[model samples]
Target: MAGSENSKCRGLRWALIGSVTLNLLVAGVIVGGFVAHDRHPPRPVVGDVSLGAFTEALSPEDRDALRRAAQKRVGDFRDMRQAARTDMTALIAALQADPWNRAEVEQILARHKARTIDRVDIGEALIFERLEEMTPEERRAFAERLLKGAQRFDKRLDRDDNRPPRP
Candidate 1:
């Protein structure tokens, strides 16, 4: 009987130890997540549109300048975004109509495309203005960074192509 009791006590002790260790491990994970999150705050969305790798290659000052310029025209950006959303909703409705209307769908698509082009034009103008402000040397440096970024992108694409298909 004493041996049985001793074994039961050992089992309980082990279970208690395991529970404490598990709780500590969970606590450690939560703390680590918070620390990691604080280490890298989110990047700001410039003009609510990605300018692609060209924007990525810009110098910090130039990027900030461009961001400020975009902000000044925030109203236009907001309107364009709202129009885009409306267009999508309309397109979906048109797609679901009982009697399909190809002309209506095409009209919505054309409007969407025009809005997209307008947004791109605005972004391009902002970029061009920023470039104009830079000295020749600064522009050359920007070009070099742009080229390097493109090369890196191409290498990544090549690597992805060589990867085996996922199971």
Candidate 2:
């Protein structure tokens, strides 16, 4: 009778241990799947448009100015991003070298603060201006469609920060 009771106690302990181990394994698998999904999600398919056709509607000089401004903005944004990457790399290395590397981190953050990049909503402005030129009924219809698209776009933007601007 004592032997039987001892055996039952050992069996219960083994069952509890097994259950705990299985739970941990399942949790690990779920976490790994989430990380993998985030690392390699499907790329979006972007359609191409003609630059010539896009600029055809504007005056020659205005079109040229717009093109130049767009180029400058893109270049500025790229330079800032490059600088940010460099700063982050240095900060990471510094922190790894000494966990309390506050000075280096602060210096990098200061540079980021000084290099302020302004985001332009040029496309949004252009769309609004063009819509304003249309007749009231036409404008209302265009606005309705635009609102629907903007809502969808906002939702997508919320999910993926790198979505391209619509033409």
Candidate 3:
């Protein structure tokens, strides 16, 4: 009976040790994640949303110039973003109305689309201006990089197309 009790006690002690070790591991992982997150916060997206791949192809100096230009017009972008948010709120309210107003929803969508176009236009203008300032050689290099980026994008799309649809 004593031997059996000793074995049981040993098992309980091992279980306790295992539980503590697992908790320590989890706590360490959580603390490490927090430290890593603090070290590398997410970067804000600047400039045209549609031109992300094209922007990536740009030289660092050209990219900086575009960023500076975008920053100069930050107020305009901010206003547009705020307007978009307001439009979205209105859209949701329209969707939730007791009597569905199709016309109201359509009008809100049209306004949202117009705002999007305006943002794209600003971004395109910035890109065009930067291109004009670049030397012919730089432009050629940029074109090559842009083509490569496009090819990569196409390949990714192809791979995604072949993937099974999610339930």
lDDT by residue (tens digit), candidate 1, 33-144: 6689878785454433358888878988887888888888888877976776676667667767889676886787688669879988988998899889999999999999
TM-score between model 1 and native:
0.66
Better candidate number, 1 or 2, judged by lDDT? 1
Candidate 3 or 2, higher TM-score:
3
Kindly list the per-residue Cα lDDT of model 3 for residues 34-90, writing each as its tens digit. 679777875554643346778789988888888888888888888986786677668
Candidates' RMSD to native: 20.0, 18.1, 18.7
> Distance (Å) between predicted and true CA of 107, model 3?
0.7
Q: Could you tell me every candidate's TM-score relative to the true structure?
A: 0.66, 0.33, 0.64
Computed on alpha carbons, the lDDT of every model, listed in order, comes to: 0.78, 0.55, 0.78
Backbone atom clashes (below 3 Å) for every candidate? 0, 0, 0
For candidate 3, give the lDDT of residue 106. 71
Which ranking of candidates, highest TM-score first?
1, 3, 2
